[model samples]
Target: MKDLRLIFRYSKPYLRDLIIAVGLLIIECAFEMIIPVLMSTLIDEGVPAHDMPVILRQGGLMVVCAVLALVTGLLYARFAARYANGFAAELRLAEYAAVQKFDFANLDHFSTASLVTRMTTDATVLLNAVNTGLRPLVRSPVMLFMGLGMAFILSPRLTIIFLVATPILAAMLAWIVSKVAPLYGRQQSAVDHLNSRIQEGLTAIRVIKAFVRGDWENQQFDEVNTELSDASTETFRFAVLNMPSFQTVMYTCIVCIMWFGGNFILTGNMSVGQLTAFLSYVLQVLNSVMMFSGVFLQMTRSLASARRIREVLTEQPDLANADQPVTEIENGAIDFENVSFKYNAGAEKNALSDITLHIPAGATVGIIGGTGSAKTTLVQLIPRLYDATAGTVRVGGRDVRDYDLAALRDAVGIVLQKNLLFSGTIRDNLKWGSPDATDDQIWAACRAARADEFLDRMPDGLDTDLGQGGVNVSGGQKQRLCIARTLLKHPKVLIFDDSTSAVDTATESGIRHALAQLTDVTKLIIAQRISSVQSADLIVILDDGRLHAVGTHAELLAHDTIYQEIYQSQKKGGDPQ
Candidate 1:
């Protein structure tokens, strides 16, 4: 019931269309009801007395009613289709907008494949259900009761057949709905799993082919595909039973009416015309019951989809702007006061713990850490990507939480460890940093990042398409392009989280030298190589989740054991221990 209310709320915007459709359907049903009564009058009065005038009058009236019903029914279909399609478009857009507001923590709560299914497959199901439901759901009950009332008026004795059969048919439908509803939920989940597998395979196809695992991938896909097929078959098996059960009950009622109604006519209590009209009313009522059963079947699937969509629509984003937020950053200085964090609340260990540090405005700070030492985690707090669990993170002399999210992020630029490029020309990708940046600004940034070396050789140069994820470019070239894009932002603070790992040492040195020219912009670089940070104004050493040392590189080499070990290992051409 709660999930259903959510759907109705979204449908409120199309209320005008819904009202028009329902009104037209009611008029159409009323017109159809009058036809049976006219047929009875023609048979009882016109045929027996051989009155051509009465016959023509009633027959013409029936034709007029039928035409009116057809016209109104078509209009109802048009309005219903308009409402359903418009409602679906609005609902899909709402769900997509809600997803865009989600923070990293919220994203972690739902799987990517599951969210995709909710937006597409589940939405499609709801659309179909709305379309079918609008017409038959409104018309069926009205037709059933009107038909029953007419049957009673013609002959109360024949009406007893419907009174008994209706309950039995309702119970059969209820049983089928109970058995099939849960299966539809599971079927949607199976689709999510199948989609997840396909996404994983496509994204990593190069790795799979390199390892020659095509057969293994195929076997895995087959397993999930079989599961989906089996689930669908089971759900439909229960749904199919609805038709046969209702038909049996309907035929039984007809047989009872015939046996008893024949006696009523013989005793002069009813006429042949009245008996025929009663049978028509009985068929109408029973057919309505059968139609209702089909509508219920569609509703069962829609109910499951509604619940999934509700989950997304109701989720609260973990990050939001402050009520009274600072709109601009003062400078590039950053300070962490006893900061600590954990990716999950109930996890056993912290990813970063009890760190107090400060980098002066416009200073260059280098951070070196072993894996799992929280180098990325620490830098992430600067832009409030994840809030500190225990203490405060201040950027530009103000708590990060006190600043508007957009303002804080704009001031801090980061080239992540795993860089990505969208499917567009190289110029399009660079515009993400500053949408209005001129071509001169773009070329200047590229020159600083040393990405121009390859761009100079391409026929299209800046206009070249970067295929998906920059598949056409080499790894080092992709990294350089990402760096150039970030440089174009001209942010007050820059953090490079191992962004130069793929580039040659000479190229990396050139990038560093060019970045040094931006004297007023603060810089923080995380690297495993000692040479990468040896020239920094300050170097910080981290081990596990704790900051172990902070000093100039020469001071660290003399005093810090961890720093000395790393420098010695790298100098001797061996992996850091």
Candidate 2:
């Protein structure tokens, strides 16, 4: 119930619609209850007395009640649909906005597929539950109380049957609820697992096919699918028991009433009209109970979904803006003072340890390190993707924490190793860096990144559509286009995190040469190849998460053993010692 309150909060904006829907449902329930009483009147009074006028009046009244109930029920359905769908839309948007606020550490806490499930499938489940449950939730209690009062009025002895049955039925329902609720949570988790497998398979289908692992993939999918199916079947098996148990109790009560009521009528203890109305009331009361069972089932499932949604809604992002944030970055100079970081706080070893470095506003700095030396992690701090666990990272002479997040990130342009492009035209993808970039500015950036040569050769040039993830382009071409897009920002600091690895050495050299012309923008190039960063003003060498050396290419070659080993190895066409 606590978790379900989270979902109700999303419905606050649709309160008017919800109130209207519930009111209409109550009216419809009143009308439905009236029909049973009217039917009993037609049977016992109108027919026995041979009163044509009475029959016509009663029949007409029944028709009017039926029509009124139909109209009100339709209106209720309309408002319920509006309320439910609107709530779901609002919830989805809020979850997505929350996810956007998450820093890298926060995102790592939940997988992409799990978040997608929470936003889509879990939300849809709640929508269906709200839509289907609203009418019954409102109508059941009204019908139960109204029907019981009417039954007592006709025959208090028969109403006693309900009193006896009520607790027994309630106890049964409670037991079922307790058993089924936990199963639904497990079922939703199985759904999350199934969705993750499907997402992973689709995203890596090319690699799977290249590796000839299609059969293995199919077997893996089968295992997850089987698990989901088993979970669903197990949950519904417990759920289906509710109907039979309810119907058995209801029919047993009906038989008891018929046997006892017939004897009462025969002995003149009750009139036929009174007995018939009593039977109608009994059915209405029991049917309302049955409706509650359905509502309970839906609520059980929705509760699981609500709990998942609440997790996302209540999660505070690990990174947040300062109270008094600086909106402008003065320059690109970055300083790291004894910074230490860990992807996980409890990790035994730091990803970056006691790192200290400074880059002037316009200097080009190269970082060369082994595969696990955390080169990318070092550059990521300048933009504050992940804050340092121990020391300070300063950009433009102010702590990054002091700057507005949007302003800080906008001033630093980064092209990561795994370049990604959305499904759009080349111009559309490039415009992401600067939405209002003119065609000339686009061309200039493309020329600087060495992407213009390929663009000119293409049939539609910049207008050409890039398929999903830029699957239409070669790896090197995608990297260059991503570089071109970053160049469009004209950021104060530009970072290449092994972005040009796919390009041939000559093209990479040409791109570097073009970057050198931007004398005012600070450049930080992270590369594995010695030739990539050998010409920079300063070359930083990293080993085992520690800064081993920092000097010019010639200076490191003359003095640092690690740098000399790397340079000699590259020169001799051999692996580094």
Q: Note the clash tally of each candidate.
A: 0, 0
At residue 314, give the lDDT of candidate 2. 86
Worst 10 residues of 1 by lDDT: 568-577
Give lDDT tens digits, candidate 1, residues 1-577: 7997887688888889999999999999899889889999999999999999999999999999999999999999999998998889888998999999888888898899999999999999999998987677888899888998888899887787888887898789889999999999999999998999999999999999999999999999999999999999999999999999999998998888888888988899988888888888888777877888898999999999999999999999887889999999999999999999999999999999999999998889999999989999999999888889999999899999999999999999999999899999999999999999999999999999999999999889999999988999998999999999999999999999999999988899999899899888999999988877888899988888898999998898899999888889797895332
- For all predictions, the C-alpha RMSD in Å is 2.2, 1.7
Best by TM-score: 2
- C-alpha positional error of residue 540 in candidate 1 after TM-score superposition, expressed in Å: 2.1
**Residue pairs in steric clash, candidate 1?**
none
For model 2, residues 1-577, the per-residue Cα lDDT tens digits are 9888876898899999999999998998889888878877887889999998889988999999999999999999999999999999999998999899988888898888889999999999999988888877888899899999888878888888899899989989998999899999999999889999999999999999999999999999999999999999999998998999999999999999999999999999888878878888888788888988889988999999999999988888887899999999999999999999999989999999999999899899999988999999999888999999999999889999999999999999999988999999999999999999999999999999999989999889999999988988999999999999999999999999999899988889899999999998999999988889988999999998899999998899999999888887788985232
- lDDT of model 1, residue 113: 93
